[model samples]
Target: MRPYRSVLYIPAARERALEKAQTLPVDAIIFDLEDAVAADEKENARVLLARVLGEADYGGRARIVRVNGLDTPWGAEDIAAFRGAKIDALLIPKVGSAADVEAVARLIPDVPLWAMMETPAGMLNAAEIAAHPRLSGMVMGTNDLAKEIGARFRPDRLPMLTGLQLCLLAARAHRRIAIDGVYNAFKDDEGLRAECRQGRDMGFDGKTLIHPAQLAIANEEFAPSDAEVDLARRQIEAFDAARREGQGVAVVDGRIVENLHAATARQIIARAEAIAERAI
Candidate 1:
């Protein structure tokens, strides 16, 4: 139940941003060497990031590197450079199939792999991609998906629902971490909060963010509230008492608490505890 509440992307080429990220209250940092870096700086960014990762102590923050796609000229080299580097995961962009995961897995056997689910083919074959044994997470690439599918911007994201839901379903079915796409409006705090709430309600583990300004809202929206935590504790206690008396169900605030509900309650408590522990 590790927290994936606020995953921020920092360009690998920017030394100052990389140094500053070590202090940000983010659950994870995506050391981006793909979309964020210019073509000419790709090789230099990879080298610089590898050096920073070795020397920096980011505490409990998960350090994941987003590499260019294998189809790109710099992709294979990016994968090779991080082969022995200390990283939690290697994020492969435009991953359309399990074979795409295998291509990178063979090179970096030690670290876990995460996929950028963006293209139409990727959405349709999400099950196979999520089922890959080495894959640990799936990130929604909403901007790219919208561009590829010719979708217009809408507050509700009606046009992007199918692709978002498809990848989400696959990630859950395979028990992989599912993170929603970024909200491009970095300055729009209210808009970000609304989308974060929507993603949380849809069962995403967290949301990917493009800027540091988006971190606080994301961490708040994805984490369990005090009221929710209290209810979970009460539900568990009530369920335990009911089972002791040969009862199969317990009532909490007029809602039935069965084995399934108790199980969910336990998970909520565990997730909250994990987040607290990370803070420490």
Candidate 2:
């Protein structure tokens, strides 16, 4: 899990995105080597990732390389170059089954894999893919998935939740992170914020981002809200007082407080406090 609460994407270009990464407020950076880089620039991108990974500590932000799929020409070299580069995770594109994940795991036994749930096969095999030991999480590539399956986008994403929840359930089953896909409307700040909130409500750890403009909103949406934090603190204090009294549960704001609620409160407080710690 690595204690990540928010992640932002940086396009693959040694010149353009590198300078940007040094300034952004994000928990992790997905240095894009797959879709963002031109075919001709992939080699340069690989070199850039290696150099970036080797040189900088990334300001506490986890560095990830989004490699091309194993079936592509650049994929093999991407893996070969990135394995020893100190990346926190290897983002594998278009993973269909646990076998696909296992194959990559065999190649890089130590690095964790983030499976892309993009195609039909991927959605169908989501559970199996998440079952792999090296599978650290699933990221939805919704644009590609929609194109591949001809799924229409909705105002509320009702059409996509089945696939999205499939990935979420699998990740939860394996105790892995589930991240939402990039919201394509980068220019529309309101839309981006709405999508981020939607993804968070859907139980995603955080949404994948395509632009630096989306960073602040993603971080805001993913972090515990003031109301939530206050509630969590109250729950924790109430439960602690109850435990001191040898009570298993206690009333909190007229609600029946139980251990499950206490556990959630503890997690929320920890995450909120962690976020505050990072800010300091």
Candidate 3:
């Protein structure tokens, strides 16, 4: 959850793609064992994924595995194979409630869990799913959610707004990271930029990307601007000064800056620092 400005998905079945991911600038890499892999390639993909993970040096990128659900024949093997694997978190697909999280949590109690909020049921029980002790973050499965809800894809994402906000609220309420869904038009830079801006405006921590092409845009859009970083520094300084003076609040740029705003500013600075550290 350390400022995942661009979380890229790499098909676990493709060794070349996995090798290529080592050089990408993505904040996180989802070694996909689900949708990206074919049914016939499940076992081989899991084996290859484990080998790559064991042998490769991913630098600062967060390595997360997107495993198939328990309902699938290969799901159990997928989970078992990753029991002691080197990974940041195990992403469980179609997590509808706390029980779904618990089901996988039982297998790998030590590893952090990430849930996919794609179903209507998952949306309704988002708070419960997010409250799980092992749960670290939630990823919006917009494509699956749209298909399940039979909603058409809109450029403005008017249809998915409620679901997106609900998931974000639940994640924030529980102190967990919430990532926005992918922009389907990976080649449409303008559309991707607009969507990344919208996601940032709506309070998403970062975005789940399908292609490497989307990384730069997501990283740029989600990062705080120069003006914002400067304001955050000023707010923190002013707030500290007001506190020393026995004042309850401080004024910054003609607005009342309270401890709450200062707290948010600190987080922004910390996020910026985390991003910088990853780059180094």
| Predicted candidate 1 versus true structure: per-residue lDDT over 1-280, tens digit per residue | 7899999999999999999999999999999999999999999999999999999999999999999988999999999998878899999999989999999999889889999999999999999999999999999999999999999999899999999999999999999999999999999999999999999999999999999999999999999999999999999999999999999999999999999999999999999999999892
What stretches of model 3 exceed 4 Å from their correct place?
none
Clashing pairs in 3: none
Taking all chains together, each candidate's TM-score versus the true structure is 0.98, 0.94, 0.97
Candidate 3, residues 1-280, lDDT tens digits: the string is 2778889999999999999999998989899999999999999999999999999999888899999999999888899999889999999999999999999999987789999999999999999999999999999999999998999989999988999999999999999988999998899999999999999999988999999998999999999888889999999999999999999899999999998999999988998888887782
Which portions of model 2 show Cα errors greater than 4 Å? 1-3
User: Highest lDDT: which candidate?
Assistant: 1
With a 3 Å backbone cut-off (N, CA, C), the pairs that clash in candidate 2 are: none
The sequence of per-residue lDDT tens digits that candidate 2 reaches over residues 16-88 is 5776687778888888889888999988888877887788657767777889878889888888887766878
Give me the displacement of residue 62 in model 2, in angstroms. Answer: 0.9
For each of the candidates, the C-alpha root-mean-square deviation to the true structure, in angstroms, is 0.8, 1.6, 1.1
The TM-score that candidate 2 achieves is: 0.94
Count steric clashes of candidate 2.
0
| Reference-based lDDT, each prediction | 0.95, 0.83, 0.93
Q: Which ten residues in a row have the lowest lDDT in candidate 1?
A: 271-280
Q: Which of 1 and 2 is ahead in lDDT?
A: 1
TM-score, cand. 1 vs. native? 0.98
